[model samples]
Target: MAEQLAQLADDRALLGRTSTAERVSDILRSRISEGFFPPGTRLSEDSIGGALGVSRNTLREAFRLLTHERLLVHELNRGVFVRVLTVDDVEDIYRTRTLVECAVVRGLGEPPYALDALAGSVEEGRRGAREGDWKRVGTANIHFHRELVALAGSERTDEVMRSVFAELRLAFHVVDDWRALHEPYLARNHEILQALRAGDRDGAERLLAVYLANSQERLVEVYRRRVGEDG
Candidate 1:
C-alpha cells in the first residue's frame, strides 16, 4: 500500500487544483488499466484520498464512476476492489471491440487518413518486443487499437472504448504467457498500418477484423480455462 500511495502521490500533480470526480476517476482508471491496481485488489479510500489530497467524498465519487465503468466493484462490507472479469465478460468485450473497431475502419470517408499515431504505436510495439518486455508490448498493442479507433474522430466512441479497453486489461492480467498473448500482434499491427499508409482501407479493415477475431478466440479460451481453474 505504501508503494501504491507513493505512486499516486507522483501522479497528484495531474489533478491540479479543485479536483473533480471526473479527474479523480481518470487517474484511477489509468492506474487500473496500467495494472497498478490489478483484479481483486481492494482500494483503500482513505489511503487513496490522502494520496491524491482529495476529500473522502470526492474519492468515493471517483470510485463510483469507475464502478460504473466495470473497473471497480463495491462489496457490501468488504469495500471496493478491482473487478475480476468473467469469461462471458471477455467475450462481450471482444464482441464490442469487433463491432466498434471494424465499423471505425469501414466508416473511414477516404484514404490518407492521419496515420502518424498508428505508425508510432506500431513502432512502440516493436521496441517493446526487442526489449523483451511483453507487458510493454501488450500496452503498445492496446495503444495501436486505440489509435485505430481514433480514426473515427468521435469523442463519444473514444469515451466508450476507453472503458472497454480498460476492462480488457483485466482479462489480460489473467494470462501467464504475456509474450504469447502480445507478440503476434506486433507484426499484425504493422501490417494494418502499412495497408492504411497505402490507402488500402479495405485491406486494413479486413486485417483488423481477422486480428480481433483471432485475439478474441485465443483470449476467451485462456480465460475459460483460467476461470474454471479458479472456480
Candidate 2:
C-alpha cells in the first residue's frame, strides 16, 4: 500500500502547480478514479498522509474537498470513506451530461474546432483498450467528455462537470464487465469526433445524446443492484 501510495505521489507531474491541499486532493481523486480507493473503502488519514508525505491538516482539507465533490463521504462516527453512488445518482449525472455536453455540441460554431484535447482523449482510450487497461480506457472516456464540455466555452460549467464525472465514476466501479462496457465506446467516440470534424454539429450532438442515454441505461441496472436498491 505504501509503495502504491508513493507511486501515486510521484504521478503528479500531470497535475501541474496546484496548492498543497489541492495536490493531495488531486492524488486522492486520481486514486479513487483508478479504483485504488474503491466504493466504501475507508480513507485512513494516517496511512495516506504518511504515504504521501503530507501533513494531517492538509490531508484533512483535501478530504473535505473530495467530500464536497461527492467522491468521499464523512460518516457520523465511521470516518471518511469513498462514496457509493446509487442508480438515481447515475441517472441524474447522465441527465446533467445531456444538458451540458450535448448543449456544447449543439451550440458549437466556426470550423477551426479545437480538437486537440478531444482527439487526444479518443486516442488515449484506443491505446488503453489495446493494452487491456479497461480502467485507463474509462478514465480517458471521462476526459473525452470533459473536453467535450469545454467546447461550450464556460469555465464554471467545466468545473461543475468535473465533479459530476467524479460522482459518476463511483457508479462505474460497480460494473463487472469493464472491457465489454468500455471498448465499444472507443469507436463511438471516434464517430462523434468525426461528425464534428466534418462540421456536422447537429450530427455530433445527436450522437452524443444517444451515447449518453445508452450508457446511462446500462449503468442504472448495475448500480441499482450494487446499492441494493429495491425495484
lDDT of each residue in 85-192, candidate 2, tens digit only: 867778888999898898889888977699889999999999999899998899999999999989888999989998998888888888898897788899999999
lDDT of 2: 0.86
Question: Who wins the TM-score comparison?
Answer: 1
- Tens-digit per-residue lDDT, 10-48, candidate 1: 989999976799999999888888888889999998899
| CA RMSD (A), model 2 | 2.4
How many Å off is the CA of 96 in candidate 2?
0.9
Whole-model lDDT, candidate 1? 0.92
Off by over 4 Å in 2: 1-19
Candidate 2 TM-score, true structure as reference = 0.90
Error of 2 at 89 (Å): 0.9
The list of candidate 1 runs beyond 4 A from truth reads: 229-231
Task: Count clashing residue pairs per candidate.
Answer: 0, 0
